[model samples]
Target: MKVALVGNQNSGKTTLFNCLTGMNAKIGNWPGVTIERKTGTIKGTNYEIVDLPGIYSLSPYSTEEEIAREYIFKEKPDVIINIVDATAIERSLYLTTQLLELDTKVIVALNMADILEKKGIKIDEKNLEEELGTKVCKISALRETGINKLISEIKKGDKLKRKPIYDVEIEYLISTIQGILHSSDSKIRHSRFLSVKLIEEDERFDKYQTQEIKHMTGLLAKKYDTDFEEIIATQRYNFIEKVREKTVIYKPVKDDLSDKLDKIFLNKWIAFPIFVVIMFLVYYLSVGIIGSNTVDMVSNIMDSFSEWVGNTLQSIGTSEVINSLVVDGIIAGVGAVLGFVPQLIILFLCIALLETTGYMSRIALLLDRVFRKIGLSGKSLIPFIVGSGCSVPGIMGTRIIENLDEREMTTMLTPFIPCSAKLPIIALFSGYFFKENSGLVSASLYFFAIAIIIISAYILSKLVFKNTSNTYISELPEYKLPNIKYIAKEVWDKVIAFIKRAGSVILICSIVIWFLLSFSFNFEYGVDIQDSMLASIGKSISWVFYPILGENNWGATVSAIQGLVAKEQVVSSMAVISGFSEEVGEGSQIFGNNTIFSSFTAASAYAFMIFNLFSAPCFGAIGAMKRELGSNKKLLKVVCFQTFLAWCLATVTYQIGSRIENGTLHLADILVIIAILLIIYLIVKNSINKKKDKCINCPYSDSCK
Candidate 1:
């Protein structure tokens, strides 16, 4: 038997999925869609479950909403579990009403019941069950409460009666619409709920019905000289308000630590500053303090094992081919990716804690004004925050954003935010080159990414995509103390996903990259190709990156190779070519006296790091962009623009820095000046043109939704 889980945004459906499936869940894209569909099996049961994306309604407005609606309508699961956030039952009920109109059977899982009780909100489960005419299970998916009851309910496989408890006026409207039915049976038969939907102007559902409903409703309206639908909608909302009054009881808001924190954290003037401080603290702990120390210690242990294994192979008369493959190919490749695991854990830990404590949403609210100025809505903040872990999941998080153009732009630029995968590269360069000021380097890189995104959004808003007409309305959920168990589970899930990806795609790519550098058919002999490939490729592309990376630095050389795969591989690729085992600490130097190290100026290294950090992200990011943009042409544009920007930034940095270092200007310096002037001109032209256009004609320019 197959079952599907659906829910509203932040409705705890994912928590339920995690609890039921444990470690058995598999996440991948839905066929022909970028939306991720999580598949897993219920433990010790024959039943399997599919966790569809959390959506507000079964409307074909967004990819996530479409996926949920399609799965239920087409796949026709044996059962559909609609997880509802119990605290905000009124808003959540909107989706519930729509789901009941569908062909599939549904069980309402009222999640977060524990939180509701704690807030002194009372829900009469029996009353709710009778009113909905479906099985209602009050389950706290996070606390493992009422889960057994839910599972047993699902296992029973009983169908409940279908009924309506609508207001009398709405019910009358429904009956009147039903009286005009063209046939007693039509696959596109309109429900009373759907009839009301047409009145409410629900564009998503109105078209799904046959023309009979529209024609009949029009005739009735003309006969009455009034649109009955609008009158009934007002009555339905009134009835819902009355139900809410009886079903929900609210007490005076209580003061808590979370509230106290929010007072300072969410202050309009200081919130941005506080966020900055918090970010610094995150990096300080993750990369500068505890996490960084742990990684160095673990790397030292791995280094010992590497040396021991190398000696053992030497004693056994192992061939250079075997040694390089084992040591350089397998060890260096996988180890390079694994080296950053500690930092990843700490990063995930911080994010999880913040999110669990409800700090992230506050950040979203505080940053909304700033984001709006850049032509993005505050809803995009979730995707940007999620992107900090990995661009793939980050892009997936844009499902929460309701607007198409805003979501697409967010998805396109989100990869610019440095994810955990790219942390290793940043840490490597900052440590090796910049020393203890690594924090500043890392922070500057982050700021650079933000700048790039803001600039891109501005340009895209004016030139490519126009601002969406949909207005943004977000509520700030009252803050509460974060549950430790919830935070730990969230953090651990992220870490596991990271490890799984590393074990699969990244591991394979690492091996393949090792293979490419391992063998080459030379003029007379098949030689190990590291040196030859570096010499050939580096020399050929040396002139292109010379302004930024200098003539022959290994950093530039490895970057060229890494561009074929991912930006993170630049650091790993350099480590391999430099013949460093896992012996290096965060700040430990590996290769090149003044030659490799001094080949490029300090400014050049900074520029090189910035380019890689902001440039198209990894393959995962590209795939995510492709999915979210829903167009190959758009993805290509993003990729091309990122690369172009990286080149321009790098070129200017090298020219200016090199000139300053030598105390003499060169032709490159002149080009850098010209490029800077051109950028300034472009910005001025864009701004002037926008103002002129707005002044000339704009229907809703005053209200930039």
Candidate 2:
């Protein structure tokens, strides 16, 4: 049996799904839409449950709504588990009413029932069930209460009675359209539902459009002196209100904990500062002194293991080439990444805690105004936050964003946030360059990334997504203590994913890089690394970074290039090439002591960090970008734009910082200064052009005369 879980945003539908399925869910996007579809099997049962994207209505106003409506209409699942927030039943039942119009079994799961009880809101579930013509099950998804009962209700296969939500006139029009659809031999399975949808001019049913239906809709609009869609919507809302009045009893209560906490956390003057402090704490705990201690412990273990492996192989009389491959290539490379797992786990834990406690959404609420000024919805912030953990899901999170332009822009910019894969690089570089202030240095990179994103957003809004508007509508869930079990599970899952990547992509890349670095072009072993195949290839592309790093350091170039496979590989590659396989304390220490990094000044090291942080993400994230973008052209455009921006910014940082530190100017410095001036001039010229082009006929236009 197949069950569909449907509900509004923050309605606890996902929590219920997790409770039902445990850890056995498969997550993917709906066909042709970015809206996520999560499917899982109920434990020890043949029943399959699908959790649809959260939507406010079945009116097809957004892609999420369309996906939900289309899935119900096409798939006709065995049961519809209509999850509704018990505290907001009136608002939620609007969708429930529409669901009842469908010919399927619907068991209304009144989620967050505990919250309702705490708030002194009494919901007459039996009355609600009778009014909506379905069985209602009260559940607290957070506590995993009433899940068995809800599942039992689903297994019972109780069908809901279809009810009319509109007046006689609208009903007559719907029936007329239904009759027309039948007469035309349209293959639309749900004629009644399609008829109502057609009357509302739903773009999904535009194919079934006919003169008769259009004429009848036009007549209805004329009679109502309003939009036909609005008329139908108003009636549905009215029915919802009536149902609420009959079934809901509310008692006034004093300020709750959530409200009290929001006063300080969401205060305008302190909210942003609090967010900054929280983030700094996350970094401090994950990559600062605490994280570094953990990293050192892990690194020492890896170092000891590598030494053991080398000794064992030598005892067995392993070949020198084989010994180097095993010790330097595989062990050092993969070990370099594994050493940062502690830090990654800590970071993921903090992010998971923020997400579960619902503070992430509050951050979105607080930043909405600022996001709007950059031509993005506050929803864009969610992706950026998620990106801090990893960019693939961050880009996928863009599905919640409705505006196509804003979604695309958000996808493009999300990788600018330092993801978990990039954390090792930050730790390595910061530890090497700043030493005692590694945490502060790593934290500065995050702020620098945000600065880049804001500036890039502004530039892209004007240059690419001109005149695009974004609408921000988000539901802030009540604050609750985060579930420790959930946070641990999430952190474990992320760590496991990182480990898998290290074993697979990073492992493969490591072997290949080792081969190239080990052999000359003629396949002769034991050549000087500078004369080896990898070095030759690296030299060919090394000039790209000369402006930033002050020399064509093929080792640095190779590390940067390898980062495209996985960001951690940047440090790992450097570790292998710099002969730090045995040391393994941190890549920074290895690089700092090696002659390979002798030419790198603190300014150049930071420039390198900036470049790597803002460059195109790893192959996995790039594939995600391609999938989310759904266009080869757009993906290529984004890749090129990201690379160009990283180059310009890194170049500027190196040239200007070098001059400031040493009080010396070079030809490249002059060229970089000119480039910066040109960029400023272009921005100013674009602003002037926009002012000149403002519409004179419009009241809001600045050039109106």
Candidate 3:
């Protein structure tokens, strides 16, 4: 038996799928589209469950949505599990009404129904089941309550179809359309579904348009004197309102915390500042105070473990080359990546807390006000939040933004936000250079990346992509208490993924780096560091580093380029190079004036961090971008744009910063001034040219809906 799970964004469809299949589908308050379906077997059964993307309706606006609607038509799964957010059942049922028209049986899983009682609300499941003509199960996927009953309902499948809810004329029109589809193809699965799509004039079925159906739609349009789509929508809402009257009961309650908090957190003037302060605190706690101490403790243990392995190899009379490979190559490189696990835990924990509290959703609504002005959709923020963990899925999340221009632009800018893989680099540089101010430096760079992204987006919207429009309406989930289990699971899963990365990519890269630095160009073993083949390679490309770091620091150049493989490899590469360098000392002295890290100043280090943060993301993310953008041409354009921006920003940051510290101005300063002026001029020109374009701030944007 096969089951398909579907729901609106944040309606807990993914959560219910996990509960039934014993799989871990990511859960967040943010509205993210799953570009691919995830499949898992239901526990103790042979039944396969496919979790489709979170979508608002069957009307396709993206590839994911089109694929999801296609799956129902072609795959024709035996059962459809539509998970509905019980707290907001009215809005949740909009998709439910559409799902009822499909061929398969649909079981409405009222997820989060447990919270409804706490909020002084009651639901009549019997009434709801009777009204929709399907089985209804109230289950809390989060708490695992009423799950067995839901599973049982899925087993005893319903034979009933969607009851007639529309007026007599509409129902007559629907039946006539269904006949037309059946007459064309007797093997068609979703005749009823296609019939409704035809009446709604859904563009997905434009190919199915026949003269007879067109004549009928023309008559209806003349009679109604309004949009055929809106007519169907009005009927659905009319039915939904009737169902709500029968099944729902709301009781009086005291003031909610969400309202109280939103007054301050959602305030027009102060909300943004509060968010900024909160982000800084989150970074400070994760990177500065708590993270620094925990990292030191773990670093000590790792140092000991490395020493022990080296001593054991030597005591066992292993070759010096083998000893160095085991100690300096594998352990040093991989261990450097692992040392930051403590910091990752703290950071993931902070994010998980925000997500659990439902504050993350509010950020989307808050950002919409600001995002629209900068030629971005509020939907762009969804990818930004997801990208904090990794840029690949963050890039994938751009599928939710329906606007082509906005989606492409968001994809181009998403990598500017630092991902978890980049944390080791951040922790490494900030801790080494700023010391006690590591967190401040780390957080500052984060907000700085965001600032640069905004500026770049403004430039792109004004000068490049024109006549772009964004249509966005995302639900604001009610604020709730933190779920401890969920948050812990979220943090632990991410931390484990981080460790797996260290063991795989970082470990392999460490061996390769060790080999290159160990052997000369002729493959001679145990060569001097400066005479190795790696040095030659680094020297060839190291000239590009001169503008950023104000010197041709080959080691820094090599490490920065290694980040393209995996951001964590940057630290691993550094550890490998420094371990091989004879001048580098132990502990904090590794970055001292006489060591391998001596070429770096505080300004250069910060610039280096910025460059890597905004540069072409890792190859994994580049592939994701390629897939999302749909061609090599678009991917190459984005990659070049990213790299060019990184170069310019790094150069400006280094040149201006160094000048401030050294009290000198040179030719670089003039170039930086010219670049800034060019950007300002572009925005000015765009503003003047587009002065008569449609204003997005019109209050009646939602009037039709």
Best by TM-score: 3
Best by lDDT: 3
The reply for model 1, stretches above 4 Å from the true place, is 1-3, 21-35, 39-48, 77-80, 100-106, 130-135, 152-170, 179-190, 198-216, 219-232, 256-258, 291-299, 477-531, 580-587, 591-598, 658-705
Candidate 1, 480-588: lDDT as tens digits: 5666666676678877876665566556665655555555435322353434544455556667676667665544655544743665566556655545322333334
TM-scores for candidates 1 onward, in order = 0.84, 0.91, 0.93
| Candidate 2 local lDDT, residue 141 | 85
Show where candidate 3 strays beyond 4 Å. 157-161, 665-705
Q: What CA RMSD would you report for each candidate?
A: 5.2, 4.3, 4.6
- TM-score ranking of the models: 3, 2, 1
lDDT by residue for model 3 over 447-508, one digit each (tens)? 99889878888879876765458566557777878777778898998898889888898899
For model 2 the TM-score comes to: 0.91
Please give the CA lDDT of all the candidate structures.
0.69, 0.82, 0.84
Q: Which ten residues in a row are the worst by lDDT in model 2?
A: 25-34
213-250 in candidate 2: lDDT tens per residue?
88878877877887777887899899888888999999
